[model samples]
Target: MKIVATEGCHLIGKNGERWIDGMASWWSACHGYNHPHVREAVTAQLQRMPHVMFGGITHDPAERLASRLAEVAPDDLNHVFFSDSGSVAVEVAMKMAIGHWRRHDRPGRTRFLAFENAYHGDTTGAMSLCDPQRSMHARYSGAITQQFHVPLPRDETTETNLDRVLAEHSDSIAGVFVEPLVQGAGGMRFHDVNTLTRIRDACRRHDLLLIADEIATGFQRTGKMFAVDHTADLPSPVVPDILCLGKALTAGTMSMAVTIARSHVFDSFYSDDPGAALMHGPTFMANPL
Candidate 1:
């Protein structure tokens, strides 16, 4: 059925049928549909300026948002890269982690590590990080860049398996990327908190970056500001080196996504050489509205 409109938690179909939004518009419509606050804010933005090029320009809204996210996100994730969609956000994150090592003199560190039941996003780079066991992109297997996949961390040996993969990849892997806490498109798989801590420990021990795909688990979805919040109390102190967020940014009122990186990761791209800079930028990035 085609949705003609929405109010609160209900969607009105073209035929005038009212249906409760069970999926919350794929978990993006956290404030439900056509919310007054959302409408007002968007209307206010539309009045000011719908968009402007992110290249060679900056905007107030984007600045405020980046600041707010930096304040709320865990660890040293203070750098923000705005993108147009969730998939693209994951792509940016992949580049950020890969670039972090690449620019830091380990250019061969290109592959990423993901688990068997993980799901990051739909774009090719993002899809490459998605678990291939039952991926929707299985048909594209031959063409997609294959990433190292570890079995879902069900036991203490999960760390052992990760160490094995890292050892095998041996400096070729950019980092271990996972949809922390609840793996969303990967069947909503939820794991024990210890599992995440173990993963964090393994990354730290192996000196690899940790990329947390918080696109679906962010914005208080998992009862905390982000799923990573659940890992704060872990025995080993750690946080994601890079975090990807979307779906609920602007309360899902607009198509917006962000890749947040720690100062360490961001600093790697800071160099006197022009070639050392991160060159990825979407036209709609950091749009004013």
Candidate 2:
């Protein structure tokens, strides 16, 4: 089953047999494979500039992409930080949440509360946010920071339990992390708008941040630009303070991901203090390609 080539929505095997790309390269190839337009864009950019360090230097592609992402993102998530993968993007989001609290004088708010069947990413921070009992990172339990894991609030009782958990751990909880409507890696679990609304209300009640890991549900995978968009009809509407996007971001062409934050979260770091900035940096972050 070795894929030698990819064209349109099919994969060419070693025996020249064509197979449908059912998962679209792990949900990254949104426009199929080898699309002429995508190829043209990649080629043009490749010829112009393939890679550049995104430290003090910036490029048009990065700025344009960031602006476009800000325009399409839900709510006022305008600040974007680029990363090389979804896991790292989730890591960055966790940092943003923790840093936001630390800058505001709540350094103790370092842990996250996530679903019992959630899958954020494989990185250290993101892995800690995944399902503690069922995720692949269970073997590394002692190696990672212990966080609160609760069941999805599908019913009033469960929702109340979530509230109780938040009430008990709100002080140390940096925020609530969720994969929104569908928990892709945590068994493709699906929850409705009511569930999302409950989570949002809980966060609001506890005055905690909400981090939505949309890496698998972003880019219309769940019939909306993001899974969080499904809750847009609620009376107050669910708006995550931080959003993590990846996988389909580069359309399977290259590695790219972004962590977007609302103004309040971004404002936490908006200071003249040199130590106030996010110190993490990925060398391949914002690669021109």
Candidates' C-alpha lDDT: 0.84, 0.91
Which segments of model 1 are wrong by more than 4 Å? none
Give the Å error, residue 184, model 1.
1.1
Q: Per-residue lDDT of 14-65 in model 1, one digit per residue for the tens?
A: 9889999888988999988888887888889899899888887788898999
Task: State residue 201's C-alpha deviation in candidate 2, in Å.
Answer: 0.5
Superposed Cα deviation of residue 238, candidate 1 (Å) = 3.2
User: Residue 78 in model 1: shift from native, Å?
Assistant: 0.9
Q: Please identify model 2 stretches exceeding 4 Å from their true place.
A: none
Q: Clashes in model 2: which pairs?
A: none
- Model 2, range 178-211, lDDT digits (tens) per residue? 8889888788889898899899889999999998
- Superposed by TM-score, candidate 2 places the C-alpha of residue 188 at a distance from the truth, in angstroms, of 0.9
